[model samples]
Target: MEPFMSDLSALSSALAATAAAAAPSLVSVHSHRSRASGFVWKSDLVVTADEALADEGEVIIAFADGTTRPATIAGRDHTTDVALLRFDGRDVSSTPLARDVPPLGSLAIIVAADQGTPVAALAMVSKSAGPWRSLRGGDIDARIELDTGLRRSSEGSLVLDASGRAVGMAVRGPGRTLVIPAATIERVASKLETHGRIARGYLGAGLQPVKLDEGVGAMVMSLDKNGPAAAAGLRQGDVITALNNAPFSSMRGLMRELGPDSVGAVVDVAALRGGEPMRVALTIGERPA
Candidate 1:
């Protein structure tokens, strides 16, 4: 009994220490639409959930010290659900983004602020997997789900690993808690810092992955009326086998090829129509903001 009690005490102390160490970087993000949380990055940048800023009116960054500053949206990417806001607060202590995710069932600490004081929740890394896309089209390097069942206010909370390094940002999900992995955060943040938005190519078609004899390809589930695919004479039920002669395995694979750089570029689409092979040339379009 004594040994178990001692272990529990030590774990509590460690979590408290980690929360304290991460306090300075955690912030409460208040927008016209809702209030959430975020963390300082670099000196002038703050990262938060993009959905928190979707209303996009006046935004305020509130610290545990009771200080507040106005922030301007530097950039936002809906796909990754990350938004970068510019706030040049003096002597800002930023959290370092961890390069790798901890193993599943490891302790994950979620930190936020209450009246300028750090509050935290200890949870396990419930789920972690390799590169995947969100239903909304974010191409994330990994998926991390926490077992905290955190509140909506936990949105944008900084999720830290055992070493107190930030591993992800918490976001509200349907009946669950999700943390956008650190690698995805860093990648999207850098792009947002430079481009103000993620550059995504648009084929203007709804697609699903279909198994093929050689590999996999995206089957056109539907096409936007008069959109790129339609303009290129593509139709519903077309199994697109490849793009630019490269194998297209899934909808995400097709999306990867349709990056912002591919917009306005003409590409060859290899497809199967009525069990017959054919190819079509079409120009990719820029995704509407």
Candidate 2:
């Protein structure tokens, strides 16, 4: 019984130490009555969850020391749920990110800030898998799910591994808490820093799903004269069945193939033109903001 009690006490102490080490990087993001967590990414940049940020409002970042500063949205990507903010203030050091994904069932510490006060939660890595696509068609580098009850104020908190190294940023997913892995942050945040938005592939045709004899298809209802669909010779009323040899039964399924990585790639389009089968090559273009 004494040994068991000692083990528990050691674990509690270790968790407190880890939380203390990560608290300095955390900040509370406030915008138009919406509050969320964020962390210092670079010298003058902070990263937070995009979904929690309001579209048009003055944003403020409150540090653990109770100091606050006005920040501007440098860049934001809805697909990855990451938003970068640029602020004028003293530089805060960011925690080291783990190069590799943490193993399943490992200890995970969630460090967040609530209105400039530090908060912590302990969880375990419930699921760890390879790269996956979000329902919105964003490509995430790794799939990491945590078994923990995440608070609304901790949406963009820093998720750290047992060694106190950051694994990723914590965000609320469809009824669950998910970690946007470190590799994904590095990829998307860097682009956001440069371009302020992630480019997505666009076909420039308004499509609606329709039931066909064999399966489902997207019928083009409108066309942009100067868009990729027009360049591929696609006209209104053409029912597209497949793209690049993969069949899609819904509009979302087809759009899933047009993620950021799909931009600038040429694809083979399979569609029916006036009851006749036709094939055309289309070069995907960037979607207009």
Candidate 3:
């Protein structure tokens, strides 16, 4: 059913007012669907250097014209798809995420478009290292769940705090959404802008930690050959029993154990090749994209 004009007008008014008041703090970017390629810049966000985003993925902005843009993909970290982009920053206005940044264990609510406009919502801070999720019919993860706000938000809406500081950017979700923290985004932006993409090392394997069945060794899934694991002969289904002789129950533990140096160093991978206990010493490769 068509939304009542009065309701749309009210919402537009509220959003417009908020944006107008905060426009100085936000950058506005304007791009349009080009008959040739994709979207061409109609305009860019204009803001002081202080207000300019650090160059991470596209920032969601309010257009003075009342139109919305989805987003442009830029420097993406394979390990973390946190990217950067320029936006049609003309109407640029947004209430930043709150300041008292959510604690390490605090919750984050990120709203993005499900259909058209954003519906307010929340997402639990799964762990310090994300892929944050917003569960359906379950207690909120980040103490934040969409209260029906994702619909109007584009993929790049900034999730703000009560005071209007940016904390999280809405990226993806079903009931569970993926958001890149602002802090992480800031760190990745400069590099992305300089390189047009993320410039992280490559480790070609996609590995997952799983509880092995009795008699089964460590379990690895989501194999990526170009990753460190594959470079080190770590193949899919290669059950990991030990990393550098450290017994790990989870992949996070394993990754932590390897750390950054693992990118170029060789590590002993103890595993059950096929029910027979064995070991394969492979050199860790670069961080694969």
Each model's TM-score, in the order given?
Answer: 0.78, 0.96, 0.49
- The C-alpha lDDT values of all candidates are 0.84, 0.91, 0.45
State, as a TM-score between 0 and 1, how close model 2 is to the true structure.
0.96
Candidate 1 vs. true structure, TM-score: 0.78
Q: Name the better of 1 and 2 by lDDT.
A: 2
**lDDT tens readout by residue for model 2, 157-195:** 999999889989999987779999989988899999999
Tens-place lDDT per residue, model 3, 125-177, is: 54443233222111112332232333312445555543335565554455544
Show model 3 residue runs off by greater than 4 Å.
1-17, 22-62, 66-72, 78-81, 87-99, 102-149, 171-179, 196-215, 218-239, 246-262, 273-276, 287-289
How does candidate 3 score on lDDT? 0.45
How many clashes in each candidate?
1, 0, 73
By lDDT, the candidates rank as: 2, 1, 3
Candidate No. with top lDDT: 2
Judging by TM-score against the true structure, name the best candidate. Answer: 2
Please give the lDDT score at residue 68 for candidate 2: 97
How large is the C-alpha RMSD of every model relative to the true structure? Answer: 5.0, 1.4, 9.9
Location of the lowest summed lDDT over 10 successive residues in candidate 3: 33-42
